[model samples]
Target chain A: MTRRATWRRRISRMLLRCLPQLMPADKVDWATAMTREFDYIADDSAALAWTCGCVLTATKMRIIAMVASFTNTPHKNAITSVAVLVVTALAVTLMVVAPRTLTPAGGGMAEGGHVAFWLMYFWPVIMLISYAATTRRGHCLPSGFLLLSLICLYVMQIGTALAVGPAMDALFHAFGANVQAWDTTLKLALLVPPLLTVLQWLALNRLDRTLTVRSMRNDSFAA
Target chain B: MTRQRKASAQTVTVLVELANNSGQWLHGYAISTATGLKSGTLYPVLMRLKESGYLESRWEASPPAGRPPRHLYRITAAGLRYLAATDDDQVSTSAATR
Candidate 1:
């Protein structure tokens, strides 16, 4: 086979592997069907076209499923409101605490710390306002809530990196153990938050699925 | 209960294709090829039809070696009724226009 043909085949194989992950759980059978159909096309370009179409279809289906799962309920609304309030309070607390804890008594924060502090302070408030606007326009626990939560999570992460790294270094020094402050801060700030964010997103999806299932069961009983 | 909504032109085309092969179970790719609909368009229509009891589907029981089984769809009795109703609607509208 030509190198170009070989590359097309490899790309199509890779995309086909991702097709099922792109689909919602219930649509796995359809994803399988589409993947199997790809084996029947003789022409490489046609196979690639088929794979792209299936990928687009799966993505569209997944988005629709997510939106449908988040249909508005009073319970969801209450939970979301409480969540927003808690995040806002956390942001406020961080805004107040980080500056005091991180800055030297007679001087200001370092330039990077200063930028991180302001970002940790303001981004959540802005996201909260955006979430409010979206909900006011009548959406069911808008994806904005997720975005807000993620932003708050990053802000908290920044605050932790600023506040904890120096504190840890000092403790380690007191124990005659050496640790680099920048290394600790960089790890705390960069690596941990993304991992936590992915967990948070997964947890949110599980929660939403549970709520949707419960509400559906209640609705069926009502009917 | 399925709501009675107007079927779009593409929907009608799909229905007609499936109705023509009433007893035979056709998989998605074949239906897409025949109806000139992309996979993106075809699957949603199939989902709606199945949800509305106008169609039924199952995974193929047996398949050729080295190939995974595909999901096969067939028109239900209610699908035939829907197609008949749609044809009648078109006929009356055309008659009125003439």
Candidate 2:
């Protein structure tokens, strides 16, 4: 084969390899069929066009399958997942910006501010570890242990809020800032972490349930 | 009672092609060429027909040396019934317009 023809053949083979991955698992047989049929097309350009069409078909099927699965999911579970993501974004923003706002001008952070700062800093890491542990051990760990872990995370968040809110309130009072409006704002702002932690727990629980149900359905179908 | 929806023009074209070759297993490429349907459109239609129990498919029992087996498709009895019903619907609609 000439170099150009050989290049076209190699590209077609590479795309054929990707066809199965683009298709849904149950429809893999169609990908295999398309690959085998490619050998019969003598014209290189036609073969390439056919291969591209197969890839498009596989992609369209995969997207349809995904949308169907998403629709199958409970609306409450979907809503909770979206809410968790949005709240987590807000919390991270607050964590990054709050320290600057809370620190007294030309001085260090308010008393006990470091406690809140470090807790907020490490909060994402803590949540990551929690998520990894829960999902990885989802089958092995007792439900009680999972609940206990979530409760502990929640308590830590609430403790941080209670501790840091008062200290920031006191610091603002000493600076003779209007305590009347600032006091309520400080308390509410501090509650975000704990609220986020609760949402995380709910989201995790919903995910776990959805996974368990899916596996059970698959098992039943297999049997 | 399950209400049957009207098939799209493309779907009707595919069904007619398959039904015309009843009892003969057709491969994807041949069907694409014969019906003048592109692979992207043809495969999904075939999949939907299979899912709806109007078509059946299988791997070729034996393939040429140095080549993998191709998939083959055939229309089912249900598919013929569906095609006939569609033809009747078209005939009645055309008569009504006249």
Best model number under DockQ: 2
True contacts kept of each: 0.59, 0.71
Candidate 1 lands at a TM-score of: 0.60
Clashing pairs in 1: none
Candidate 1: stretches off by over 4 Å: A75-199, A206-223, B1-3, B88-98
Model 1 per-residue lDDT tens digits across residues A55-138: 888999989886665554456554664455445444444344444445554577643446546666565465545444443323
lDDT of 2 by residue, A107-167 (tens): 8886656776888768768876776675653431234444445456646665665556665
Global CA lDDT computed for model 1: 0.66
Instruction: Residues B1-98, candidate 1: write the lDDT tens digits.
Output: 98778886667777878888989999888897887777777777887898889999998899888877888999999998988888666644433432
DockQ, every prediction: 0.49, 0.66
Error of 1 at B1 (Å): 12
Q: Which window of 10 residues has the lowest lDDT sum in candidate 2 chain A?
A: A137-146
Residue-level lDDT for A98 in candidate 1: 43
